[model samples]
Target: MAKIVKPLSDQQLLRYSRHIMLPNMDIDGQEKLWNSKVLIIGVGGLGCAVAQYLACSGIGKLTLVDDDKVDKTNLQRQVLHTENNVGLNKCDSAKQSLQQLNSEITIDTHTIRLTGEVLLQTIQEHDVVVDCSDNLTTRNELNLLCFKTKTPLVSGAAIRMEGQVATFTMDKDQPCYQCISSMFGEQELTCSESGILSPVVGVIGSLQATETIKLLVQIGEVLSSRLLMFDAVTMSFNEFKLNQNLTCSVCSK
Candidate 1:
């Protein structure tokens, strides 16, 4: 456990007074959040909500990576960017919004597309990684890198009024994203094809934020080896057990 060097300033304490009141999230947990770092890949619908929550929660540092620019179509679900930011790089827009939400957080924006090398380096820098990208290829790549670096990954996806969230790590000997991908098979639909409800992303993204906080504070059981499925229309959630694949090329190999 890390110790606080100095008492929080009155204003700082006042700002986080509510968080300080949580039983498990006392001054120490708040300090842990302030000292921890996280990286979010893809600033799309889910990423928008995840960034807003994490940034406002007083995370010390946040690295946002995205290659695309804000577009009119993105306004439907991507809440972080607005009409005025339509042409701006998504990462840049996210940085600006995150800074305004919590100036205390150090926000780093990368406008370039994420390759394996960049993803590996960014994961190494942060204590936790959140996958909000829409594609499976990126998610699989991220999972491999996370496993290789021993970093914990929070993965979330939302489509057509439903969503899912899971945490993957090699640390607990739990099934990784690679295992899930292999079990489910690679065929998946993008939000573009199936369409996603606005609040569906919000629900899953908030869960991602929750898991990220837990990982940062090293408290509570992460969703390792469990697939949490959410249904917005029915407002119900179900979790299925996940199994590690001994033959998984990315994790087992």
Candidate 2:
């Protein structure tokens, strides 16, 4: 006889009943979610949403990495934090919120800055890596690390009224984040200067969580070679095709 998969316990069934009811995310998908592990590189605006959704969605383990502390300004787009969390490390606040959101899943917090060697060590432990960082420098570093480790990376960014998301796989054909950055250059605005809408970040971050889940469950088509761009002001969505740059320092490796 084929191996029998255990059914979810009553409490777990109750907690994820809605997801269990969906054909796409039935018990099997939920089981896959429950067994998958994801590493989120930042606990800011995008990380806040990505972590919350992934934890609540039944991911088995999460490793959060961030070096910043909460401040009054982060309240605008960093919903996982609050006024009380000011001066506290973002990882601490995120852990508090995630534990409250779902105590069933385990969270591992890293309160240190991510650098070359450190980044590689962390990516090796998780099944997928989510880049919720805000700067191009750290973003490129993470892309290189993920590619070198042969890990799937779900990269998302939001600023002003626009946001973009893409999944980079280390299959040699997919356009990595470094490739995209080289083509577009780092001409985008930052929230510190240009500002961002809270909901815009929320929308993009939530999609990052969705993409992470899809990649973890091995369900649906992963956004491996396409960029999903959203413009909230016009409420328009566009997908631009992306190819692995032959000269890409990261992807070409």
Candidate 3:
């Protein structure tokens, strides 16, 4: 069943006036965003940036998932949390921030880690999923779930002045995360261990947000089938074509 979004009200028209003025994203695109639902998995640097942009953009329903609590260490890049929220759950803190950004939008918070049946149910509830998780395990799980459910996924990662963003729509001819993960073995390095530049995650997260909006509005060329890699040291971006592995387990059918 398709969601029937109400026409923008006078306040909404003024609120999104700049967006409506755009050639690509006029009233129709803004309405599409108003009716769209997005599930964001993670509340760290990437998640914070992604959530902030999407919230301000007027996404109809934004669900934030994270099991961690805010820490003093996160203040540097986790823009959604302040020193006052240092002890609160990341999802709760993020919800507060997002609500403050746009009171009209609905913000849902899940403070538990996603897995098994819960993960599947959550993914099915949203039109799109954004993977801002840190670990390979969570990323792999999200990839499989999105593929199985046929939900579009916008994935982003940042660490040590390097960042990458990709979109997977579960198209049989397109490459999924599992296909890309298979190329890079099991080694995983986290920001705490490697040390990350603050703005790197911001750049990647912003890109993820852009891709998400583009996907929802059906405007512009999406990042699907391409992996965008950013190097802060050189301030350059490289694009790589992703190939689907026909023999791989996930999305091979």
Best by TM-score: 3
**lDDT value for model 2:** 0.89
Query: How many clashes in each candidate?
Result: 0, 0, 0
lDDT of 3 at 94: 91
Q: Once model 2 is optimally superposed onto the true structure by TM-score, how far is the C-alpha of residue 213 displaced, in angstroms?
A: 0.4
Question: Model 3 segments beyond 4 Å from truth?
Answer: none
Q: What is the C-alpha RMSD of each candidate to the true structure, in Å?
A: 2.1, 2.7, 0.9
* Model 3 TM-score (2 dp): 0.98
Model 1 lDDT at residue 202: 86
Predicted structure 1: lDDT: 0.88
> Per-residue lDDT of 194-219 in model 2, one digit per residue for the tens?
98999998998999999999888778
lDDT minimum window of 10 residues, candidate 1: 1-10
All candidates: TM-score: 0.94, 0.94, 0.98
The candidate that wins on lDDT is 3
Q: What does candidate 1's lDDT look like per residue over 11-105, in tens digits?
A: 87789989999988888888888888899999999899999999988888899989999988889989999889999999998888888899877
lDDT tens string, model 3, 1-253? 8767778888999999998999999999999999989999999999999999999998999999999999999999999999999999999999888888999999998999989899999999999999999998999999999999999999999999999999998876888999988878678898889999999999999999999999999999999989999999999999999889887788887
If both were scored by TM-score, which would come out higher, candidate 1 or candidate 3? Answer: 3
